[model samples]
Target: MKAILLHGVTAFLLSFSALGQMQSFSLQEVKVTGGAFKNAQDVDLRYILSLNPDKLLAPYLIDAGLPLKAERYGNWESSGLDGHIGGHYLSALAMMYASTGNAELKKRLDYMIDQLAQCQAKNGNGYVGGIPQGKVFWERIYKGDIDGSSFGLNNTWVPLYNIHKLFAGLRDSYEFGGNQQAKQVLIGLGDWFAELIRPLSDDQIQQILRTEHGGMNEAFADLYILTKNQKYLETAQRISHRAILNPLVQKQDKLTGLHANTQIPKVIGFEKIAMLTENAKWSEAARYFWQNVSQTRTVAFGGNSVREHFNPTNDFSSMLKSNQGPETCNSFNMLRLSKALFLDKNDPSYLDFYERTLYNHILSSQHPQKGGFVYFTPIRPNHYRVYSQPETSMWCCVGSGLENHTKYSELIYSHSANDLFVNLFIPSTLHWKEKSIQLTQATEFPYKNQSEFVLKLAKSQAFTLNIRYPKWADDVEVMVNGKLYPTSAQPSNYIGIRRKWKTGDKLSVRFTTSTHLEYLPDGSNWAAFVHGPIVLAAKTSTADLVGLFADDSRMGHETKGKLYPIDKAYMLIGDTDTYISKVKSVGNLKFSLDSLTLQPFYEVHDARYQMYFQTFTQNEFDAQKAKQRQQETEALAMEARTVDKVSCGEQQPEVDHSYKGEKSDAGYDDDGRFWRNTRSYMSYQLQNKGFAGKTLEISFSGNLKTEEVGFFLNDRAAEIIAVKDRVISVKTDNTELITLKIVSENGRPTPRFHQIRLMK
Candidate 1:
């Protein structure tokens, strides 16, 4: 009863011993030779080849006293966060090499490892990093002289976060790239770092953990797994922040106002330590975090957070209104965490969210034909996104985006001591080398809703094969050798067939998919149509796609195009049932709904599409329309007056607007608006193009107490003033441009400033 009532029905699908003992198949054992995954792998390989290796290696070479062969990248590469891309490139090459067996990628992987080894040897103390003056920075932290914040440590731009990339690269190099040399380099680097931090107390380590460290705990836990040493294990446990992990272990939702990506990687570390150390409390913490995020916080697109930070779950207005919506890196990390939880517990719920997110968010992120990756997927009614190029855009999404497509076969199938489980409908083949069993699966799935599996065995074998009955399927029909295998099985569980199987035996499973409307988690009036596991979206228009194809500009990741008035958005013309019933299936994976054309989200690239539709009750349609029209008029007028704007706590915007500050900190508010305030001063240059604006609006959250403020325009200071309004308007007489600055002279911190915009 505990198993059935707590987890899903598949909880008892396997024996207790088998559940704990099962492990993932090696990349070599299972190969994906066909399906849409193979096509994506092709595109990813081409994109990998397009990136210049010499450019990525420039930082390492420069720091190692070696000459640079190629120029470093522009945006993030030349910025303070240098050498991060080199690490992602290494991991991408390693995974691509393992998955595809590409000889060129393997060569590149070996070359990168060799260069890193050279850099490590030159460092003279087993320390290797591409952060400029990183040795000096670590020296300061080693002596207990640390000044840390959300994004900086000891006056450096996320040095720990930057180094975590190298750690991940080394781990992936040995795991997937199959390079023995990388193992030594990785272990040496770990030992070097451990010694540096060995003198620091636990309190100091926790203080350092306040900043974004990019799964350093996860990297340490992985190292423990690799070496079976307790020292690294202790280090991992010591660095795991109690403030974040303790509340989670108690099953609390304290995620609001926190950095989304930073905490996700920490939870990944927690789960890894739990698995390696057999600590159930840590495992529960990870599981609880997953449930809270996947169930209550997630959106219709299977993603959460707005502007790269978690918003209060009770309100999703900002999730729908903000142009900087759910981030691809957050989903990327969530999938990693979901995979870990699923392998640990074998719960159908994890697979449920995994399938939805994979189909809707991950698959839709990449432009099918253009081969560019998306940073943000805005859910705003008539908004769009920007894509990353190989040479120009080196944002965080570009790093994770490179790894997204090459490994689509990650969670397709799993096996135990003598049983196999089919988790996904992706077409692939599994070769169980232990039992000499070869099972191949083929299907167009979600399009055809049926899959056929053929087993090739040299001799008769006896084992149990569990086929997952997805929750989305209405009824599952299974056939053994063209004869109906009669059973009284339902969905949300696995159906196991235990019998003697011979060579060339065949089995077929067909699913009956029924259309249904899924409402937002917060019970908002927004709805999305889900047919089986595929999320259907309607194509809107192809207008004002600013930065649709990104350039080398720092802000290229943002979609700064003109926004359509929300009042003019196409509304559902009927009630909920009528809208669902009227979605007529057209040829191919498309449908016709009134004036809209619906299709699979992953297939609808190069156009603006709507996944969540505005739904109203049959009696309240006219009333809702009237209310929306008035609200949209105010929205349009407010939006039209903005000339230039800057959103704090976001990457591309801050960088593009020449953000410079001292003693500054950033976080998101409960309303999902991001804010950055400083004890010293912070500034962002706004382009007063043609001098059209008459006033400057500096936005801040209400009820926040602040000291007297001094504003600077182009290095000129104004009289100190205290403002209580949410938005403070300052008259400007600038003819061309002005750099806005906020500061406090009393040594007190400035108020939480939301955004700065020029208004007419």
Candidate 2:
């Protein structure tokens, strides 16, 4: 049994709650013995073992002034987000250890804790981090020399966010791996952080929170639970971002323009803080956030956002058009939030979204045959996805992907007192050692509609077995030993079977599901075919899958292949009511829709596929086709004219351009675009390879005044030829590469820049 040693007092689990409503079983208690989830977990283990611990530990050692054991891994690890992956690796190892009891995972987890402890010891101030110039950076923050922006603090990339990964990893190491040293290191680090920020006012902390800080509040809350320390709890409360929380508490939808994953972790932290403090407002805020994202912002596959930013709830056109669709990290954090809500509220409805995301987004993220993590799961009709190579890719998704599949059994079965709640239908064996009851769930799940549960008890005991009837299922039939058992359970409710179990008892459930077309949340013509919780998509093509396996380049996770014209994509033309009826069963979990063959989205990989399709009535098909063609022609022509474009405030585009600035900040505009403005200067290096760039076009969120801003190409003043409709066009001489700089003239703040394009 894995247990956290809380000041020498044994806490049975990290999530142990005294005010239990519905509680999840520990990863150790439920073992996924068989099924697709088990396979995914096994594949994840292989990837986990393939990683070198020494390389991951290099960042810590370098920060601690220790001898080098190995060089740090490249990509994000060596980039500004240094040691972020290392932190996530620790978490993955701990959870995988607890879930699989894998000896190798435990070995790696122990090694990480030992190395981190050494680093913490060397600092002598409970401070250890891999942010470049680590000592200098913390010292500056300690002295209140803070320069905060959306993704940068003091001109460094997300230092708070980077460090929070370590905080989370350390917490998970103690909670899941039961590593005693981790608890001490975590407490020490918590103290160091508390004291470091002690001098700063709440306003300064809130300013720092503008950057993408992970669940720091949650980490402090976890520490408070572990040690019963008032300081940690106080720090957690103090650091909670009020700007985001206040709107949520008031039931306002202010999330559309925010960074999706960044806000998700914050909400998770909010939920944790609410749980610890029993703050009803905070709890409601968390629930409100979930409801908005899951109902309004989320897509058919339980993923949200477009290009890592939450698109406007009323307009999802960007989601269907962008190659950078919903990010994997968003759903990963969403699941964490959902689980917290489900456990707290005892609402089985939370499991509906959980199950959908688990089956579609999370399951489809990893390549089955060739184990690689995915960063973006594009919803564009024919655009493919890019998978992350273990050595080269260290995107945020890779970090979350490392932890995604390892603990599939975490929520299969939850309990309240003596009553057992089977929330998910995954095949797993649950050992309730406290009650001496062993229950095994066996099923093919979506492939087959039936699941069988067998129980083995040491002695006869009367208890309630509550099996969730998922929201997707129309109706469920329960049978005991091949005889019908009466059930009046409705969808999204649980059917409880109260009985006195013997040594051997059997309960079987059969469910009925129907194929349906789920339209985009914005009520657009685009829709995805969903059968129960499984989304069905067609493998459109395998050609032009460039960078299918990612390279070490900063933007390598993007699919740079040809984006097939949206107008030419396969569309459903006919009666809307007949779409579902036209889907003929070709095989199990596979269907034939006209000439296209549809299968479970989780089964589609290594190819360009279509999840969402535009539907049209037969009479209006020609007119819509003509309209789409006109739009596509203009879009494609503009794409062909562009040499390179930089999304000014976005993370990847700025990072890829070697973005540098002073007195610069970023924000999302009302029209659903990100913009960056600077009082001093901001510059990005754009490639003019082939010396084909003839014009520079800069777009702003507001009207641009030429007199207010100065444009320079490679430090030389550029001649502005045209300024019209928030766009400035400047003549550009042919140069192989140039640094484009935007300066605020006479100390006036520059107009918010939305995009910079180098046109040929």
Candidate 3:
């Protein structure tokens, strides 16, 4: 929800050059005094406090030339993505300190910075990282011995993306926590990073950018601002991927089938560089990307993608079919993009999207009490989410989740040269020491439609007050001192009130709230109910919420519970308006349906729930019921007859199934289906315990080079006599474990493999 044209790009670009020269009221000027956000922040702070700082610091200490006082946590920490969460913790703690001035958080931030500083000092060359054997890895990469992929570089798990976390963390520590030592350490690390690629040509860096180097561009831009170094600025521009940004700037939507989270953060850096360099074309490109994603790509709850990739814009059936729904990290980055766009354009649409996403997605991602973080919020009917325990889970979502709640107070209030803009109604206080004004806002928000703002000043002053008019509200009312003020302000814009204001001046505004039906972005019949900005959902059942609290498994983020048939789930019978009208609010944020109670998604926890439901008219419902029942029967029969299956080329499945390969590559087709093939060979180890199946079935496309594929099972040659309907069914003897491999003749490539399963 950044900018929707409150001002043109020309005006913004013209003033952008001066942006680097001027500074706003320091971020320390505002603090979260009270409200839902403050409570959530407090909960996050408690969760962070429960984690042993020494254990979290183990990786940095190990990398920095210090002794580890604790063992590394399991799951991703013990896995390849080690040291990532430590970076996120530094950022979250620093942000929490700035937002609330919690002394404990400050101590934690200072401790982490000090530990990392020790690591940097010992490295002696401004090099500080916790990627296991990072010295050797980067040295190899520095010498141009690179083997990179989407998630790996030189056979290591995204060390660049991993280290970017620390770069951003150190920057946040210095910027937010005011650690002077962090600034020096941060610059040192940036210098090390810059010089690491300074020897390589832009072509080599572009090739390196193909890997998911999370926000290296944004981090470099921040460094440029910090030291005013031209080299860092050039490095930021060079780090950007032209493949993604070029099409976007030309308004070409080349984002289909691309990794959604990987690209959004890159576009955010594009916007930042646009503002810093006064390049309006890049700014326009970012705006287009935001609009494309927000309007077309996003779902009802303000989330986007399925299986962590952007599904086709013309089709979202994949979204409903998969247990892995919209990722929390995607929304977190989208909010960042929205905030950046909002700052330059003064657009209300940006804040509107921000409020919707913040409440419905970001706020809903955290476990309110048990202190865990949710990775994927599945929309599939009767499917549940898995929560990450602090000691076990180290997912990317967990890292972003730690920072999400701490950032609620970031946009509550912003200002101009003379005017004060109240962007959000979150109950917080903004102290403008330079202007001698202190504004305090208090509201129950989505539950209560009115918010009160109190103005306190040392003396009388003249300035304008711009309050946002949300699109969800109707007949927005503005009152000064309990009296109706005469002003006509349209929804989805800022309503300004300018006058000489004295101390203790009270301003109140009320927004009329109502419920509406939001459909899937593809214009499908499936829809979710929304009461104002909050997405309202019903708890369908709690049966079989497997892994509600996750184990320390690699695939713990996925909801592995049984997907109660979509056809059997709650069906909103009636027309769209009828469904909306029938939604009855029981009390507070809960709504009553026939067999379930609908509540805000953030409030519905630890249960199986339905956010989107199938809607149909009377005749359509009856007809679809019979057709859907048949499809369900066939689908279930197929599932019941299968032993174990692996989705080829998908990240989680490949790794979980022990995928091993040489000279192999993975990619998606135009229809967003992933496939993997190898020039040398590739294989997967799957389960076949107590199996009666005698056939191993492998699916492939008709368009691939399949004739020369040599099949092997348990290292024994298996004859694939002929292909039947694009599937090669190899007769096999049943065993406890099945090892399947596909090899090619000479150096030729194998066919694109889609799925491998054991079938009766």
Candidate 4:
């Protein structure tokens, strides 16, 4: 009987051990030593910590002032500050402080907490904000009349959104930074939130949530984790925006027109809830949304959309037509979501997207000289980038810009206790706490397709090391201890090698390149030019075009208003037989443009360019290549004529240009010519000249601010005010003689007008 009992006990013990292994939930202790986040000095900790308390808390404290003071967003009677910004600031502060221990940051955080406690006391409820208009906005939302057409109550959600940022910040501070007081503050805020919502039914709550609110669910889930309170979890579940949540959970693409970043935080909350509750469907739903977006919708730069709205799938032909595409903040949130998914699945594909965006978009978003962020990375053929000012431009990009440069260390290394994953090839060092091992990765990467890893040991430890081979690399080679090893995983997957790694072990990897062509969803035959992972663009000479007007300085010149075909602009000088050869080979992965000899698209600045082109087959190319040559010959001939004849001409040179007028009362001359008076502002009139037998070119010259040139013809309005170095050209049917008119928004006449001409 004793022997039988012993056997059963041993079996039970074995089963328990297996269950423990399966249920492990702790995040592996992955420490980063190098990369973007490495400290330059001992005071770096203090500087990082200062991000929250000294920087973030200082603003709120100053707003609050002495006694029960909080800084006013604007006027409580008029301008109401939203909670989203505040929430992010607080969250960032808390997280930064937690990541780096700084006493100053802690002190500022503590003081702000005390001040908030006082404000809560004074309000006689859980309410605490600088804005008193929040109460009125909440009442209006409760009454179901939020259209944002009015001024006062329409601004309600702003404050709540800001508070959400604060709540999230506090939570991160507690969880990641080890600030217990942060947890206390978060719990109080959660309790207050519960009290505010308990009186309203689900229907009423849903009505109140219809406005443009940020991720309230994310904050509630965070609170749940801090307190382990079931009520907080319930709140998070209830606050899930059903419009977004229902479609996402149902595996539908109702996300076409939805705000990009606004919806991401809610899904993040869903991911957290799925983890906490062990709900398989919820986890699947979250993962599905991420996969669909990160894979199908993203552009080569790891961004999507042409106008902040998701265009129809596969119809990227219209991608370069708008200025509002791919908000920087959207990239920020998408990357955050990617990180979360990476932790959950341990997949290498997520890292691929992360690396692409980090290099092409996020890294380039910041100006290298000024450290200011670009508002938009314009893909429009001739549009220039607008950058944010250091002090004045507090746009959405600014908020994201603050956090983007600080978190590069987060993805450098990740592990699963027994295996270390080297994800990104950024120069960095990793200290694996569990194995007591330090691994240093040094590489120029993407630029120089080689990376080396050096192992350091306090004591020799045995572990598996997994290195990711990017999807762009084709001929990848890996070596260990001077012995070559074969790898089976394709690019964009991990090459895992388990071994008893000793001190002084070195691993070397070499990645080769290949040329790839990506097709747009629309059957427009448009293709993106890519070499390996890098997207290339044809660089053109920088033109000082104004925002909307054309320059009259080159009036009557033959070069003005000439539409040079793209083939002529970007001369294809390299061997067309092999597309890889067409990519001008520079040493390493870097290549120069064959047209203007400029750097890659990501490096090009202050230049008009094209990244996508319409490719033709060999037979078609042979037929069109001659025409392309002829067009180039004509352009060069025209350029020589202008220089020889117009350079010394006395009369204002007559340059032929065309402009289409809008349907409004802006009139044009019989030849479709319009004039702007230099003294009294006069709007140009338009008259449609019937297209007789052939296409006619309408040309005009005016000296006005680029912002002042507005041309309207055929129900279309074209502002040529900011015509940089390139002349305006458009092709239309001969039946419509498009009228051309230039008008200034400020009603100011142009400084000079040379002549207007129309020709067939």
Candidate 5:
């Protein structure tokens, strides 16, 4: 293979095994012909075009000390996570241009690259970012004046994570859009970043890594591949968080309390670096993580985590109850990781997960008609999702959502040296330029159980065509030219057929799908209906969708609708053995369960829906109903009484409440609870919006040494009312904004605090 030149440097050569594995077609090499995915692609294109690049460029321009063309977007863009969507937009425009050959997307991508190049020129040190006070922040890091938390570093919101998006965007623009200018900008930015962290010790770098830095290792690894600079590769290794990597390398599951999206990207980086370096230990660790997360933590729809953090694998009650369900960004990153793993290992199993998540989570995350993106897909009964409006919302999910639908053609077809793999059955046309092969796949998959492939070739050529036999498919049949092709292939593997393929030749595949009940991974009583790779959900109601279309509010992406009682949700009653039999087929990939209609979850939108249903035998129904009612009553009462609350140790909750600390630590306990404690001091700003709060409740995991802990509210000493059942109650005034501080007195450590609530 010839070494390509990038920014005056030769490209690094990959391992023979990594290079020879399943090779994915570029988005430009395949096109979505027609289907729901095509509609989604169209919608995503409109959403991409709806945004003004200048507005998205404002932050970068401001950081560059240049004139702004338009105002910065609100929500996340105007907030601390500025220019993040701009980076995602670059990627979206590049991939969308590749997928659809849309001229407008290409134009916008070129314009953005040009603008970014100008900004890079102005910065002069190869640094161009929209991070709030970008220069000063880098200067602080350069001087080793770093203070880091889970979601913040130096009192900024994920600046490292924020900038990694730009890194990825520039990489994608060059890789997909073939923009040389993006390549130069990326190299310049990479050089600046490398220098920025050069002076810091590994310990200081790890401290910075404690914050949510999105795939920094992956970015540097890609940089190494582009420039073949060992320094870039070393930087990648240096930044890979040892706390996370060491546990994974030892085949440990220390990921329970970690932020789901944060770790997923790091693992993606791990896999990438492992593949490039042929590091067996890192590769094994990456695979172990994939197996653990995919099998244990992921929901039926292939999304993982609850409220942005991984809950205990054995208990999913919090996931089933919280309005903050599996986030779209998690699935988005998971898919990227899955794609990388599949390409590296040529594993057919990864394709199974990729297909499942693509259909259920990523495909379902967009508004089909109105052209918007969903942040969270709640499993909470009667809960809905909020979609992003282009001019109003700029959340991380909106950024990932833009790129999700634009690249449905990515994994449709892949190839090795002499073989072609039909990975997914999405309706698309693949142009294999090297071999002069044009194969068009036509299917209404998950709707119609059959797919047909027609090949248009320049001449008769022999190559093995590998068709994936999905695990959920049964009695799969493949035909060539209207004749049955005899083959023996087990599920979760591929059936390869090698023959001379000429123009006008046809290949057909058919499979059977069955409706079945899939319980949650925790072995809980709750289950979801699945038809093949598609998850089925029932629309519960249309009422109380308060933020259906998100506004510019910080938490607007969350569905603030009323959460119905868990006992009141539709449940599967009677024998578990008869549950699948009771699901009478009513339509394509649709069924009737009791009085409710279940359709493909991607099709069930614009209303409140239930993906998981509680299962109860007739004998246990009444008792379980009473238990759930009592639990719900107590929980709802607390939520009703509380003016504001924060779950300590969790990223979003702490960041949302403006949690700050000195000499602090947090982790998930063996009892499946999160706690944070400080040896010095910890503080959080909570909003008592209604002035109805009379008392403050601090829940601790274990007994607190009250003598060693000092509590203050609004900069004044707080009066402790009572300490019972591990909860400390304190008297509070009618302060709208309460700044509660917990200080460790006399150099003594504070107790592990789980939650803080302002109550009536």
Candidate 6:
């Protein structure tokens, strides 16, 4: 490995300087080839260009309404109207246009820029956003109106983050799309931000920093690079989140349970700042963060998190309990971070994480039908995916949903100043214009264990073709022109084959599969099952219980359980550990299931499924098998008559008191889900609704603590209290009765109901 010489701004400056000063040096250029199944940039641009930008942008434009023209934060009802997000779209558009010379995309960007310019002009200042309530929001923050005791701010930095996206878009337009008006608009926007913050005290500034803000510093650093302006660089440094960067720079591991994507963009800014300033400490810090996250925290699916927040390392057993795990947007951001590290160090380990995530998380996010996306990939076995709706559910998945399918061409191939690196084996063709070479890689990897690449040459040229030998491939064989060459000396590293290539040169690569158990880092004796690059999940019956239609409300709430404990009713095999009689091979592919019949989750789509089963040791395995047989015999003997219900010994408590307790001490029965305890003080059990209905009325014969009564039904809040005196009454009209829970305030415990009725 060669030593990295460039540091800080010097590194960026030197790239340009070297191109200008040295006769041998030239501008390092990149472009996508217009061929079938090429690099991500190519495939991504193709998909993006195909979309009607007007259709996508129309909703936002209308949503922004007058606030877009007024240059103010609009009503809280419309969040997408904020300028920052519009900027991101423009940036993505500009990049797509640069990658492919699409005139329609350029036209859409121009219209957006013109509208934003009008908004800025109307404000009589450089301020541009859809937030009409900006003044009121800031006032509330200054008045110390803290909500939920979490932070002291209104709407946080969401508006700012959105604006940053616009700034980035303008920057990309100028640098990549050759749009000068975009640059002018961005400069005006930057000036507005500088003036806005200049009046605030350091304490006020710190208070504002508590909210989640994107990479504002990185955008400024990019501005400095483009214009060679010192002020821009200074602003970039100032915008760096000291709270996040300070801890990371000190090599501290305080990232447990933190929002993954929220902190990643800040590190990207740190990386940019380090590149511009030539700060070795910053560079080391950025690298350390990337390495730690990529290596220790990731899952077999190449993603991290259990509920949109990072969990403790190796403790993924609890991942399946919630549907909100490993959000796709987080994976998208992680891949971007991976590309940055790979470009800097060209480490094979980075590629490993990239491939794993791309296959398991990113590819899986794309819906097979509508091209919509999933918000999270639940790691719980037997669970199906919950996809985002086209217009209704425009959450974080919406942003990533747009980017995910468009950029499959970007990661297929990368090049340094001289060498070509083929990192992924997606079906794609690469055209290296400078080298006069075209390389096409063809394979359906994980589905098939082999891939082949053919090189087409306008003329013979000398270059190194580096092929990645994936970490999962126990043995890899590389053949050129039907002759097998000795394997590369390093495992889990790229094999650099330097040769003079001409037209029709061929390379065939083969990867062998091997099953491995990955033990959890925690002291728990559990492990995740993996075969080759694919993660295997146990298949169970969740599909039949829920309808698979488009209108099915059960899609998102399908399988409700943790990953470890197998539900006895749903378990097809009596014991998960000893259930598999054999691991069989169908040609080159090998599969293992309970009773020799399990399949991968991706393969069992549209069917009820489960993955990740318990593995048992030899002693426990044989014992469980014998016990299962005995239970099977007993089940046969009991088949003569139906045993509908079983009863346990009942307990009776003696009550001697004749006096009645004060009715004022009892809380209101909101849905008849709560009642007074005759034996002791108040106590409550949250009730699960057995059926679906609309109206719920609770009647109680007692003086009620009206203010104390509250109900939470299906996680939606409802407050029902007695309006008058002794008789308490409450009612509500709702169709679904999932779970109804009631509680009291002022430390008074709620009571269990004696009689509960559901109204249709």
User: How should the candidates be ordered by lDDT, best one leading?
Assistant: 5, 2, 3, 1, 6, 4
Error of 5 at 622 (Å): 3.6
lDDT of 4 by residue, 688-716 (tens): 24543122122335444555654444446
lDDT of 1 by residue, 208-247 (tens): 9877888999999989989988899998898898889999
Q: Of the candidates numbered 3 and 4, which has the greater TM-score value?
A: 3
Model 2, span 333-448: residue lDDT tens: 99999999998888888999999999999999998878899988889998899998889999989999999998899899999987788889989999998999999999999899
Model 5 clash pairs are: none
lDDT of 5 by residue, 1-760 (tens): 3333322222222323433578889888899998999999999988998999999999999999999989898888987899999999999999999888879888999999999999999999999999989899989999999878788788789999999999999999999998999999999999999999988999999999999999999999999999999999999999999999999999999988788999999999999999989999998899999999999999999999999999889999999989899999999999998999888887788988999999999989999999889888888888889999998999899999999998999899999987788889988999999899999999988789999999999998887677888999976887877877655677877766667678998889999888888899899899999999889999989999898999887778887777788878888888889888888888777788888899999998789999998888998897888888999988888777878789998888887787888878888888877889988899998887778888889999755877889999988999999999999999987778899999999776677999999888
Relative to the true structure, candidate 6 has a C-alpha RMSD (angstroms) of: 11.8
lDDT of 3 by residue, 1-760 (tens): 1222222111011122222222234557877767666777888988888787788778777877688888878788766778988889889988888877889999988888888888899999999888888888888878877655565566576678788889889999999999999999999999998889878877788778877888989999999999999999888999998988999889998877777888898998999999899999999999999999999999878899887888888889889977888999999999999988888776767888889999889888888777788888889887788888877788999999899988787788777777777778888888999898999888888778999999999999887677777888866887777767644556777767767788988989898888888889898888888888889888878889888888887778877677678788888887666887787878787888887888899887889889998889999998889889988788777777777777787665675676777677778887567888888788877777677666788888745444577889899987564578888888765787788988977677677888887886
Report the lDDT of model 3 for residue 124: 92
Order by TM-score, highest first: 2, 5, 1, 3, 6, 4
Per-candidate TM equals 0.94, 0.96, 0.93, 0.69, 0.95, 0.70
Candidate 6 per-residue lDDT, tens place, 633-703, comes to: 56434332221111000000000001122111221133312234322222122222343333334434444
After best superposition, candidate 2 residue 387: deviation in angstroms? 0.4
Identify the superior model by TM-score, candidate 1 or candidate 5: 5
Best by TM-score: 2
Of models 2 and 4, which has the larger TM-score?
2
| Error in Å for residue 363 of model 6 | 0.5
